[model samples]
Target chain A: MIIAERKPVDEIVEMVSGVKRVLVLGCRGCVSICSAGGEREVEILASLLRLGASKQGRTLETIEATLVRQCDREYIEGIDQWAGQYDAIVSMACGVGVNFIANLRPLDVVYPGVNTSFFGGSADQGIWTEQCAGCGNCVLHLTGGLCPVARCAKSLMNGPCGGSVGGRCEIHKEVPCIWQAIHDRLDRTGRKEDMSRIAPIRDWSAAGHGGPRKQVRDDLTV
Target chain B: MSFTPDIRVFCCHYTSQQAIAEGLAGLKNDGFPPNATIERLLCSGKLQVSTILKAFEDGADGVCVVGCPVNECHNLMGSQRAAHRVLAVRKALNELGVEGERIEMFHLPRGFHPEFVEAVKQLDERTRGMGPSPFNGGTAK
Candidate 1:
C-alpha cells in the first residue's frame, strides 16, 4: 500500500491562512490504512488548525470529509455538494490523490496535508517500512520474494556486497542486508541453484524514468 | 465559574480507570478541581491524536492520558502505542502555538491512587501556569 504521513501543522496552517472556511479532506485508501490521512486524522488536523488560527485571533471554520478513495473521480466527486463552500481544501491523501483533487477542481486551492512516503506495508503496529520501489518491475521470484530495489541501500541485484557484515547492512547498523536475507530464504527453501545465476542489468525505462507512465486495459476501458 | 483550569483525563480501563473509580475515593479532596473530568477507555491504545486535540478544542485547559506500564498492558502493547501517540500530539500542539506541556502521559499501576492523583496535580499546576487555552472564550473559537 502507499504509505504517507501528515505534514507539520505549521506548514498546513500556513497554506490555508486568511481563509475563514476550510475543508480537511481525507482518503480511506493507503493513507487511511497507515493512519496518516484517515477520517480520524482529518478530524485531528481540523481541530489543530482551528486552534492554530484561534491563536492568531482569527476564526477558522473547518469542515471534515473523508472520501472512500481520493484517487478515484467517483469518490472525489462525493464532496462536490459542499466543496465549493470552503475557500481552500487540505487534502490528507497521497500525492496522487492530492493531484487528482486538484485536477478535478482547477479553481479551488488544494493543499496536501501529508508527505507521501513510499509504497510499503506495516512492519509492526504503527510502524511502516518501504518494501517496493514501484520500479515498474517485479523481480521477487528471483530473489526469495524480497525486492532488492527497495530494501537494498544501493538497490543492488545479486548483492551481499563486501559491506554486508553478520547479515546487517554496513550502510546502517539497524538495517538487515536484503541480500543476506535473500540468501537465507533461498537456502532454507533449497533453491540454492537460483542463487548461483547472476541477474542481468536492469532496464530503467520500465521504471517510469522516461516520463509519467500510465496503463490502459482495453478489455476494461469504456 | 472562575477561571479554573479544566483538565481532561483519559484512563485506560484495566489500570487507571479502576484506580480512580475504586481506590481513589478522596481524589476530589486531593486538589482535583471540580472541572477535572475523567473518561475511561477500554485501552489507552484506542486513544488517538484527534481525541487529545478535541479535548483542547472543546475547552480543556490541559489533558492527561493514564496508561498501563510498558510490556504489562492488558493488550500487550496498548500503553506503548498510547505513549507514542501522546508524543505526536504534543509535537502537533507545540506547532499550533499551544504549549506542548498542556498534555502528558503516565504509566500507573492498577489502582495506584496516590500516583494517579499526583500525576493529575502536577499537570494541573503546569496548566495553571499556561493559563486558559487561547482557543476558549465563552466557547472554543
Candidate 2:
C-alpha cells in the first residue's frame, strides 16, 4: 500500500488561504489504512482548517467528502457531486489521487494535503515501513522473498555492504541489515547456495527511469 | 473585565464516576468551574483527535482529557490511547499557531478524588493566563 503523511497545517492552510470555500477530499484506499487520508482524517483536517482560519480572524467554509478510491476514473467522477460548492480542493489522498483529480478536472484547483511517502505496509499498529520500491522488476524470488531494492540502504543486489555491522545497517542502528536477513532466511531454508549466484548488472529503463509508467489492459479497456 | 475560559473536559466512565455521581450541582458545590463542560465516555480510548478539534472549533477555550491511570485503565491500554490522541491534537494546535498547551491529558485514579478536580483547575488557571482561545475572538461563550 502507498504510505502518506499529512502536510503541515500551516502549509495546507497557506495553500487554501485565499479560498473562502474549499473541499477537503479523502480517499478510502491505501491512505485510509495508513491513517493519513480517510474519513476520520478528512474531519480532522476540515476542523483544523476552520480553526486555523478562525485564529486568523477569517472564516473558511469546508466541504468534506471521501471517495471509494481516487486512483480510478469511476471514483474520481464521484467528486462531481460537490460541484461548485468549493473554490479549491484539499486532497488527502496520495499524489496519484491529487493528479487524477487534476488530470480529469482541468478547471478545478486541487492541492495535496499529504506528502506521498512510499510503497509500504503496516509494520505494526500505528507503524508503517517502506516495503516495496515498485521498480517494475521482480527480484523477490531471487532474494529469499526480500527486495533489497527497497530495503537496503544502497539497493545492493548481492550480499550485505561493508557498512553492515552485527546485522544492522550503518545508516541507522535501528535498521536491521536486510541483506543479512536475506542470507539468514535463505540459509535457514537450506537455499544458501542461491547467494553464490551473483546478480547481473540491471536494466534501469523499466523502473520509471524511462519516464512516467503506464499499463493498459486491452481486455479491460473500454 | 476578567476573562473566563470555556473549557471542555472529556473523561472516561471509570475516571469520571465521581462527577457523574455528584451531578452538575454537586460538582459546582465542590468547586468545579462553571464555565467548563464535562463529557463522559465509556473509555477515554474512544476519544478521537477530530473530537477534540471539534471542541476548539465549537468555541472551547481549552480541552482536558481525564482518563484512568496509564497502568490501571479498566481497558488496559485505553488511557494510553487517549494520551496519544491528546498529543496528536496538541501537535495540530501547535501547527495552527495556537498554544499546544490549550489541550492536555491527565491520568488520575478512578472515582471521586480531588486530583481530578485539581487537574481541571490547573488547566483552568493555565487557560486563563493564555486568555480566550484565538478561535473565541476575545469573546467568552
Candidate 3:
C-alpha cells in the first residue's frame, strides 16, 4: 500500500479560499493502511479547517466522501455524481489518489491532504518508517529474513560498518544496527553457517540498474 | 446525510486545557455543535478507541485529543501512545466510510494557549462543515 503523512495545517488552510463548500475524500487503501490518509483523518482535517476558517466568520460548506481506492478509476467513479456538489476536493488519500482525482476532474482543484511516503509497515500502532526501496527484487533469504537493503543505513550487503556499536548504529543511537540485528537473529536461529557462505556480488542490474523495468502479463489485461 | 460530529480532546494535566482555567472554567462554551461534547481524560493516552466510538454512538460530531509534547509527556510515553492511537483511529475511520478527519489528536505544551485556542476554533469550523450530525436530535429517540 502507498504510505503517506499528514500535511501541515497551515499549508492545507492556504490551499482553499472562497472555500465555503468542500468534499473531504478519504481512501480505504494504502494511505488508510498506514494511517496517513483515512476517513477519520479526513474528518479531523475538515474540522480543523472549518473551525479555523469560521473563526474569521467566513463560512465554508463541507461534506464527506470516502472511496475504496482513490487511485483506481472504478472506485473513484463513486464520486462522479457528487462532483458537481462540492466547490473543491480535499483528498485524504496518498499522493497517487490525489493526482488521480485531478486526472479525472481537470477543472476541479484537488488538494492533497497528506504527504506520500515510501512503502513500509507499521512498526507498531502509531509509528511507521521506510522499509522498502521497491528495488523490484526480494533478498530477505540472503540475510536472516532481514532486508538489509531496506534496513541498513548504508544498505550494505557484506557486513556492518565500523560505526555500528553495541548493537546500535552510531549514526543515531535510536536505530539498532541492522547488521548487528542480522547477526543476532542468525545466531538465535542456529543458522550462523549461512553467513560463512560467500555471498555473490549483488546483481544490481536486476534491481532496475539497467533502467526502469516493467512486468507485463498479456493475460492479465485485455 | 449530515452528521453532527462529537469531539473529545485529551489534554495533558501539565500543559493542556487543564493548565488553563479556561478549559475547565470555560467548559460552558455554548456546548458543542449539538452532539459535540468535551471530556477530559487522565491523559490523552487514556483515550481508548472503544471509548471514542462510544462518544460517536452517543452522538458526537468529532473527537479531538490533545497530548503533551512528545517527550514532555508527564507519563513519559503517554502522549506518544496517544498519537499512535490517533493514527489507528484514522485507519478505522477510513474503513468505516466515515470521514476520519472528524477525530483529531494533537500535542500541546503546558501553556499552548495559542495552539489550544486555534484547535478549538478549528474543531468548531469542522463541525460547521459537517452541518448537523444526523444523530443531532435522534440519539434520544
Candidates 1 and 2 compared: the better one by DockQ is 2
Ten residues in a row with the worst lDDT in model 3 chain A? A48-57
Q: What lDDT does each candidate get?
A: 0.86, 0.92, 0.71
Model 2 chain B — which ten-residue stretch has the worst lDDT?
B132-141
DockQ of each: 0.60, 0.86, 0.06
Off by over 4 Å in 3: A55-57, A197-213, B1-141
Interface RMSD of 2: 0.7
Q: Sorted by TM-score, highest first, which candidate order results?
A: 2, 1, 3
* lDDT tens digits, residue span B49-108, model 3: 556655654556667777888989888888888888777666644543346676777788
Give the Å error, residue A22, model 1: 1.4
lDDT of 1 by residue, A145-195 (tens): 998999999999878899999999999999999999999999999999989
Error of 2 at A186 (Å): 0.9
lDDT of 2: 0.92
Please identify which of the two predictions, 2 or 3, would achieve the higher TM-score against the true structure.
2
What's the TM-score of every candidate structure?
0.88, 0.97, 0.61
Docking class of 2: high
Which lDDT tens digits does candidate 2 get at residues A81-178? 98989999999999999999999999999999999999998889999999899999889999999889999999998869999999999999999999
Candidate 2 A-chain TM-score: 0.98
DockQ of predicted model 1? 0.60
